[model samples]
Target: MKKFLFLLVMSFSLMLILAGCSGSSEDSQAGGDEANSEGSTEIEFWTMQLKPTFTDYIEGVIADFEEENPNITVKWVDVPWGDMEKKILSAVSSETAPDVANLNPQFASQLAELDALVNMDEAVPAEEKEQFFEGIWKSNSFDGKTFGVPWYLSSQVSMYNNNILEEAGLTGEDVPTKYADVLDFSKKIKEETGQYAFFPSIDGSHLLETMVTMGVELTNEDMTKATFNTAEGKESFQFFVDMYENELIPREVLTEGHGKAVDMYQAGQLAVLSSGPQFLNTVNENAPDIYEATEIAPIITGKTGLMNVAAMNLVVPKQSDKQDAAVKFSLFITNAENQVEFDKIVPILPSIETALEDPYFNELPESPSPEEEARIISAEQLKNSEVLIPPMKNYSDLQKAMTDALQAAMLGEMSIDEALADAEQKWNKALQ
Candidate 1:
């Protein structure tokens, strides 16, 4: 059942990706596309909301490339968030795949099975990968083959509302740095102010930020299975259950997506939220008045320490006709300038370690206070993190099973044990 739901979401997301291309005007041209190079070599491109966002930067980079080469023209396509994965899969299978497609490690495993990715390890030397955060380099690898470069990457950052924290008499000093700390704080907020302290999502591995802090890896060292259903996994899920039974967290959080968390924080109903750096833009747009009140920080510590999501991935498909050009463009897009621009909205750590260390980590946005600024960059607080889903044939399916177990636990239809047992059975079947 979990597998079915995830496939449906992917199917829907893919359709949305293709639908974006259909809606794109012949010229959504940020800048005019230069005429195809003199030799008429054309490289097709597909991206998810990269322009005016990162696409504008991409155009500048590509235009520069075109001027220098004069032999390559890029046919770029915009993919909407909806149905994006389906369109990507379809394009790769139909012999119309992009030379470079914006992909994440989530898709890396599945596509590796579908024969849709290019293994370009030779192009991206090991030394080059040293610049990225430790786990990020391994995120895009499949069966020991490097299929993608690090584009922009960010850990799951801690976000909070200064106004509410103050109301609860909590200040920077009260900030939690561990998974247990966050759970405790959430309870405090609820007790003192009737607002949520922190909401760790069951929908996905955003909860990973906490589990990682507890020294739990989502997958085992061998990567043969989803080890998250183990003793540590239950303990992690139980943290949320304790919060729920205690009324420390709002029940809406069970059904709420990340957007809701952002909205709640923006509205001042939530004292704490966890998301990527992209929350900066959402704060700026939806609740401008409260923008200043917004703060970012690293995840609170558990017994072990701070933890969060690893990063997103940049990838090449097996059918790309212009491997060399794709590599060039991939490198350019992930460079420091582009990383900064992309982070303005996406706010994840760039894969480029130099980019992150650029004294920028110390800088906060035009937020409410120094405390708010500190909270968002809290991704750097990572003492430990988990990112070990092998590019197996059935990751998306496994993720669904886990998500379902969580949801069921949240809904109280069954205990965490019962749901996980059922999920483990389903997962073993999928493995076969």
Candidate 2:
């Protein structure tokens, strides 16, 4: 399954590279046609899986942008989240790629590596760039060049079950704010209440980011080699190994993903859940009793005090004829004023500094729900949060290598030293 998933991702990346090559001539022709045409210019825009729910809000933004710039017409397309990679590659291959598209840093980095994206550092003025949070804005940067503009961000917050805490003879104040105390807390909850404290899955990039939060340097300055085979890396790897071997965490975490964690949390099988505020709504809908018992706290971090931030970004394709107009639209949508409005519709935090300063994020009602409290706490952590696992070439491969090694160690298939050495070797090969 791992090999198949890796190959599937590689195939998609290959398609993107080939698409950039085949569409060059057509892109030049399109640019020529746009230049020769009248003053009117229509640019295509694409967003991911935001239809029906956010239709009115997005359409209103488009209407506002077009009204402000009469010469530039905007065409908005909403693509399903699961189909975005394949569909975007197909559009690029056919020279039908949108002028501006919403993408995460990982996907945008692949395009940036191929020189298929415009350098936002050169296109967007420095003064305009200062309006966004530095850490969030830097998420889209690659090799000293900015490839995308920062958009809405989601930072993890610790949500605990008040019922479970009381059952375990603990209180809300006993909730851990550092990873160093999580193991002990988990042990206490398991021993007293016969329930797991949390599920720390190694299935995806979660482990990688956790290691970084624990102060494990993933790579050298230029990212040319692996640098995580040190004492800190071994300690971080052993943290999970000890948990699993001692049965402090669920056994299914070895194979299952984060969804399983959410399920466990909803069923009251888990005491603490570290996830975004958006998930609180799902818990409320599916498990109202548990939702009522849910209490919000700051995300648990390591000694570095850094939190994890998942962000969406906007990028302008290099092949687009309307590069300038695309950048303008990207900026306009992600600007302070626009981002604050979007926050009204959803619980996500804005990337813009001034937008984050909005009372919507800072101010809470006298009787705010758990979701509202979670949002406020999440927003407060944005200054310290970042894309912990920054975008890099072969990022997925590196993540897989580390995860496999950790799993091997936890299962007693390999010693901790052997696992780290093996993963370090694999990472160096991929980096080379």
Candidate 3:
């Protein structure tokens, strides 16, 4: 592939500029400059391989984008979750930087500082910017310049086993939305079912779903220090302690990865899950029976109502010359129709207007029951469920601290209060 692009560069050099009258000797130098310029015009695209779990939906979307704009060919590469950030950072610092790639929507600030990412305000049509979720789009903006376009929105929803809930004389519809209710219910389920009520597999940031739903903002309004020791933050972390002590969540979740949670859920040993849509699809494929029997609902709220969200952004690299094509592809993928199709497979919020009207989303087909109303009820509620954090510069390291703290709490390695304070101290030190 590199040779093909290089050969095209060689061909262009021998034709136009080399044929011009320069100092004649300076033409060789011109040829090298022209070659570099030529290849930059070729569109290079990268995806984080996140959507592959749902299906080959991303491939179809990319194909449609290529068909509409035939002038540029997109080279798509998938970086796995384990090594995505490290690999992308190294690749961008080298000659292999892509014309466009996926990154954490909030990650733009650091990369922008390195001059590796483009400010989208100059690349995109301003009027079209309103198509995305406001807070999500704001994550990709820094210093008044847009750097990424919101691709999709992910909310942490609660999934429960209807059979288990029914066995305990309850249903999700009858379940409470308040944190206190959940704590009380967890105790009740432990008394009745013997099996744990929830399995919060030591996923750190992923657990933010429960916290955000509880009105606990980890960062203050000024974006400095760790306010996680505050009233709500304390309440949020205490959830782990209460659930664990009440024997609602198993001790193994402290160390087990996501696979463990899936295993238990498939076995019908776990009644409730604080999970994203990815698990819903995983259950569909791996344990089709469980998928059929399971039910989903908006995450139960805190004393004060709130919910946590996850999302992605697509951006054009500043060094690419095919940015015109990159910009077109960005807007194309985010159009309402495309987003809806993409979200149908992924089961997340499509980051565009007029997408929720689709029949597949409004009402989906299910077996042995009335048509399954999609778990998402009111669009406005989903919009309001989002929790916005500032551009976290040391997020990678800070997230590690939070993860360790969560795992410790999940395992009872440390008391929840102690873990939160240790994490807060570790995080604050980095900020300084």
Candidate 4:
């Protein structure tokens, strides 16, 4: 009987051991599933003022990217344009910046200066970098490092009112193609129709870009000192001073910004509107009659014959753990296929060379709208355009100096020479 009891106990002990092993295997399988879940990465992307307007489009893009990259997910956040700078700076300070951000070169440069952005030169492959326009691609680069990838570009196009032209006894051929002719054209319009030709706002960097287009160099070699206080610079400043004094441009130009120009154009007070083609939609919605009478032309240029190209770029923060994934998304969004689609939605030109070659940009409908014609004109001029004022350190302060000096000259507070000299002094101080 004692021998039988001992064998029975041994058998029960063996059964318990087998059960324990089975449980251990099941636990291991569950842990493996958890690891797989943890392996998938989710990245945050931030865009400026593209939420409600581009929600469906951006969401679809995210969906497509995720479908292809099954292990990665994208979380998109849209910030208001005015709020982006503060928000991005705050995020960077907290080390909680988004994995990717849509920013302009000027703003991105600030982060790049702080070493908070990824070195795109090393991250982007040569073949991929070659896909964008050389000028547009370099717009985001400074100090031998590229911080962002070019996405969308806007080259200014002159939108004139056909009714105003006819009222002024001017034909389409009479529109000015260069700055020298614009003054004469403005005089004709003011005399014939009693309407201002256009408003060249001295606000922000508009005047600075105008001077650059007029062949006034802003800085010397190595950018260590001011160089725009020369003969050409004085001439450029005097041109606007003459306009303001002669009542050719409205007095409101002294106090208002580009928005006032648009308002006046839509209201039929101004004859010409120099702005992006995308703005035609606003005119169409707000003032259908003005929209109907709108005519498109290539932007007026100065001696250099170069147009100003404004670009929006995509950037990855250095703090992002998923740098590769963020860059992949950036390239995917700005690729030829995607950029072409975006161009269709908005009249802005694509930065990608192949995207610009797409038939959509080159070809127009049989009866194209003013916006469509403007798109074509803008695209045709893109090859000759560049970011006139490339990103620079203390660029805003530099612009403000020029603006204040220009305002002083325009208001008769100082002579053109004094204004330029003052601007040079301020710029030199800022450079230091």
Q: Estimate each model's TM-score.
A: 0.81, 0.94, 0.80, 0.90
Which stretches of model 4 miss by more than 4 angstroms? 1-37
TM-score comparison, 3 vs 4, better candidate: 4
Worst window of 10 by summed lDDT in candidate 1: 25-34
- Which is better, 2 or 3, measured by lDDT? 2
- Residue pairs with backbone atoms closer than 3 Å in model 2 (clashes): none
Strongest candidate by lDDT: 2
Q: Which candidate has the top score in TM-score? A: 2
- The TM-score between candidate 3 and the true structure equals 0.80
List lDDT for all candidates, in order: 0.64, 0.87, 0.66, 0.84
N/CA/C clash count, model 1:
36
lDDT by residue (1-432, candidate 3, tens digit) is 122443344354333222221222243233421224345334667777665674376677777876776545666778776566656555554435566787776555666544456577666777887766667667677656777887877766667888888888888785555777777777777788877777765464555556665777677655567777777777777777777766677878667766788788888888876666667767777877877778766666775676656668888765454556777888887899888777655557876656766765566454522113334543434656654454665665676787788768766798878888998998888666
lDDT of 2 by residue, 1-432 (tens): 243554565576666555664465356445542532687889899999999999999999999999999888888999999878777666765657789899999978877876778889988998999988888888898988899999999888889999999999999888999989989999999999999999987777799889998999999988999999999999998899889988999999889988998999999999999888899989999999999999999998998999989999998887787787888899999988989899888989899888777888889999889988988899899889989988887877888899999989999999999999999999999888
| Model 4 C-alpha lDDT per residue in residues 240-327, reported as the tens digit of each score | 9989999999998888889999999999999999998888999999999999999898898899998899999999877666777888
Residue 365 in candidate 4, Cα distance off native in Å? 1.4
Question: In lDDT terms, how accurate is model 2?
Answer: 0.87
lDDT of 2 at 73: 88
